[model samples]
Target: MSEQHSGRRRRPHYRALSPLREHLRESFWFAPLVACVGAVLLAGLTDLIDREIFAEATAEQTADTLLSFASAAKSVVSTVSSAMLTFIGVVFSISLVSLQMAAGQMSPRVLRLYVRSRLTKATFSTCLATFVFALLVQLGYDETTDPTRAVSVPIVSTVVALALVLLSLALFVLYVQATLRLLRVPHVIDRVTRESMQVLTAYRWLAPPPGQEAAERPEDPPDGPAPQGPVLLHEGRAGVLRDVNIRRLVRVARRHGTVLHLVPRIGDFIAPGTPTVLAAGGTAPRPRRIAFALNVGVDRTMHQDLSFGFRQLVDIAIRALSPAVNDPTTAVQAVDRIHQLLAVLAPLPVGELRHRDRDGAVRLVQSVPGWEATVDLAFTEIRICGAGQPQVTRRLTAALDDLLRITPQPRLPPLLTQRRLLERAVDAAVPDEHNRAFALAPDRQGIG
Candidate 1:
């Protein structure tokens, strides 16, 4: 019975200790290192106290002083330790008050209330009064024959010890300040706290549904008022999504089901009827693909500004990296296939979408390592192969010709303002097989 009762009490204390331990783990050195530093500081304090009582006076007078002082110190140890422990407690309470002041998390009324707290005000007052009374008595007991050497060593020791205490306290204050700032930062995303009640408390009081089985599903949104779906940034517009975008979609699908039935990633000529999402008994329509300069809303001068040109370049890049793969041997075949399909589907008003196949990577000239990482975004090394493979470097350079062609036009409408232009572009959008000829990764945005 006693053991069970003790265990129950310990469990609550352990829960309270957890966050403090976690905070210290992050803010200070490792636990063993802190312990060693604490031990050394304690030793230094002990030595200072010893020196203050025993370092000075003639050998004969010192002996007498030692006898009296040791007796007094021994007799006072229990009382002084208790009182010092109380002082330490007050220090913590005041330190907390100081923090509240620093953060502007306190006001004048709260400050007055804090001042009246037993630990904050009364304990400090008691310690202050005790120290003054002790000093007066200590002054009467200082029966020294020598003036200079009699006090110098003890004074120096006390000063050093006090300095070390102040240094430690300063270090702790700085640590707390830094930790508070770190906790305030936007990225941490944790709800750690020192209070056990805060920890054990539920976010909501509603009882969880019973049983090991999962909750039942609703087929669709309510008819009374449908909840808002995601707002599209570019509604009904078509442009090839990037490699990083595809993989992110696959990962999101995994939550709904272990197996996702989707078409090839990156550059698979996503046809008009191709579906991007069919999950949770819901379906999403295919995305339209467009080439900006060729599709619609082109200016008479056929010129574009830097920003619009940059957007077109990005679209070209998306088309470049995300092409349909067909195991082509020569660069010419790759380009011919891409040209034929795109010309039939998304007819370019100007030039054409192109492709090139190379045997090995032109950039960095190294194989991509096999390891994968979400945070690092590392993927398999892209290999360029085949004897007739074109120079990836030269082709990449040639790809810039389209950017040069899209000159600045005065009358082009903002894509935002010209909804009809986007609609027309989507209507004319075509899926080119350039994605198939190229080796690219999945999309991050989950757009097919």
Candidate 2:
């Protein structure tokens, strides 16, 4: 009984934590805000300490130190504070320009990578914190008062501000290097590919090992007398369905003795009033509970949406294939990365959308795209957009052939279909026989 009770207690805890984790993952300002608040508190404490210890010290008592050192501290902090403010403006301007270029040249979705970048946020926060700290220290220093009762110059605070200034400069240099790397086409594509592969690996369906006979698909739910009145839950807000907490949903379904069929997959847009789930066999869970399991956001994220990564790469590829850009080599690079990801995904189960409870009863059912849809998502757009470019056609042909060789026999049909489509596209686009043959061949870098 105790064990069962403990198990029941963990579900709500997990349900509460999932949204918090997602928010932190998508937000860039939280960390910087914390850092700035810490800086302000530290500055206040340091100022208090400086006033206590040196408030009564006379120049004669500290003659070993130059009086100019104390007098110049205020001037130095004031000048440094002004300089740091100017530096903040310059850094933000450069960052904005880079973001604009990236959005225009690549895809606007790639801007999220920049917005969530830790280096950019940290550098900006450090500069701002330094400016604030210096200002606080300068305000604490008053040189115009009578010499008999002059406010003590905060030596420690001033020295720390100097160190922060130097640190900000170092961070600025690193930020510049990071920004330059981000601007490079190859680097951006590689990063996007790497992230997509990660998402694939995380959510990939389990499959049998090589040389073993493939297992038969799981049997569908048993047909029985239908529930008299199934409850349909509608979405509360309209947004893209970014992720779902399946485990929590399964647990809730089991607890309520209901079977839940989720209507939308990750990356799907859900409108308010649309039926989001169909619950059979019991009263539907509270709407807020159902909604808690679903993460609906204004924009799609790479959280659990494997398609988002593919979308990013596809956007880049199509942009490159455009007449204005006219860069086939970059398109080829995107194709190569997509091929790698498809190979990773090909062996895995694509439509196994059932989630079972501890007793082995199916509790949650959701729709997922199968292997054919995934293949089309990855290749179809680039193939059509780059049909006129021989280099792109050749790379797509090679990618298809390579995928056919690497993926299991069960995944062969889609690869073959894609190959035939590529052939047809190349035939219709390229009139010259030589160029057509070259495009059809499995050449890695396309025709010379």
Candidate 3:
């Protein structure tokens, strides 16, 4: 029986693929899939070539062979085009496919713009590959059979492949143009970076201008009298990786973390050191010797803004304590409870949470809930992409800057330490007048 008659219809071809097979097929990024497809087509093509040139002995047989060859070619094209149109979505699979494509492991011929950024590029590259493959195959056939030919099948295949490839390339370019237009790359980068800059500000991360040393923080107020306001500190120079900056205002840093920003206010790189914009935590600028960094994106100064409000509430609560909550030592004692309350309400975003020791066992652990943090981190990622000119470094670097702002540091003993800081906060929060003390354990206040 002829192989066709015996009928083990060639292995279930790619086009006939079930959804799972289809997925496996497209999983390739650059497209070894194309080669695999091409190989199948090549096998089919070889079968056609044999039918045309050597499969038969008589003229009638040759005529039947030619007809079969035509049918085979049509089937190949139909199969390929169909497979190209189907898409499967499973985030992990998509990521895996993307990774493979990025590594340049797949075929370009199958790189469809509908897939991914890298895949889109691969598709464009594939168009070039198709044109070459078709032309080479046609030349090989012409050299072997030099038929002067008004209708040589090899020549026709070459022409059709070439034309299709050119068309595909054009489509690919059009898609790219549209995508670039939609994304408005330059604009989006700028908008997002600016947002990142603001985020850096919120963290009090400062990057001072080059050569201009940052003003130092004043010495801690002398230990004697009731000082007027909180000490102002000048933070140090800082820079953030462009990618970390968020387009959306969503991340929040607690305490003294710093985020940095790059300033291109002075044009070219040839001129050394553009000013680094620093975000600091103080209500207003403080003249000091120690370098302090400020976060820019946030509107509230830690000392001036957010803490002020929290402390105000603390003060109100303290005043409410009046005859009941009053203690002269309350100022030093009240802060931890208030801070714990604020910590509870922080609504912190998803972050690289850190844990550190406060005492030997009382470890300071940062908690960021999942879903809530993603929105802002994504925004930060988006913003970093848009940050412009010198574009700074990678988006992650800007993010690292942002991350640093939120990066929790260990609070060890004096430098008067976390304990003292909490105490001062409570002290500042105390009411103007301490009335007759009534009673309730200070530990119940959430300060402990």
What's the count of clashing pairs in each model shown?
A: 37, 0, 61
Q: Which stretches of candidate 2 lie over 4 Å from their true place?
A: 1-19, 55-68, 144-151, 205-231, 246-251, 353-363
Give the better candidate number (1 or 2) by TM-score: 2
Clashing residue pairs, backbone N/CA/C < 3 A, model 2: none
Rank candidates by lDDT, best first.
2, 3, 1
Where is the poorest 10-residue window by lDDT in model 2?
A: 1-10
* Tens digit per residue, CA lDDT, model 2, 1-448: 0011222321112244655676675787786687678778878988887666564456346522424477778788888999999999999999999999999888999888888778898899899899889887877776654545655657778888999999999999999999998988788988888878766664343222244223433222234553343555655688988888877888889888998888778889887776777787776887678887788889988766778888899999999999999988888888888888888887666654556665656677766677788888999999899988888888888888788888877668888998888888888999999988877777787765
lDDT of 3 at 294: 23
Candidate RMSDs in Å, in order, are: 25.6, 4.7, 24.0
Best by lDDT: 2
Give per-residue CA lDDT, model 1, range 183-282, as digits (tens).
3311111111111113112111111123311231111112355222221122223433221121233333333332222322222233334443222223
Q: Give the lDDT of residue 74 in candidate 2.
A: 77
Q: Which stretches of candidate 1 lie over 4 Å from their true place?
A: 1-56, 60-161, 186-448
- Candidate-wise lDDT, in order: 0.28, 0.77, 0.31
Cα error, residue 309 of model 3, in Å, equals 30
By TM-score, who's the top model here? 2
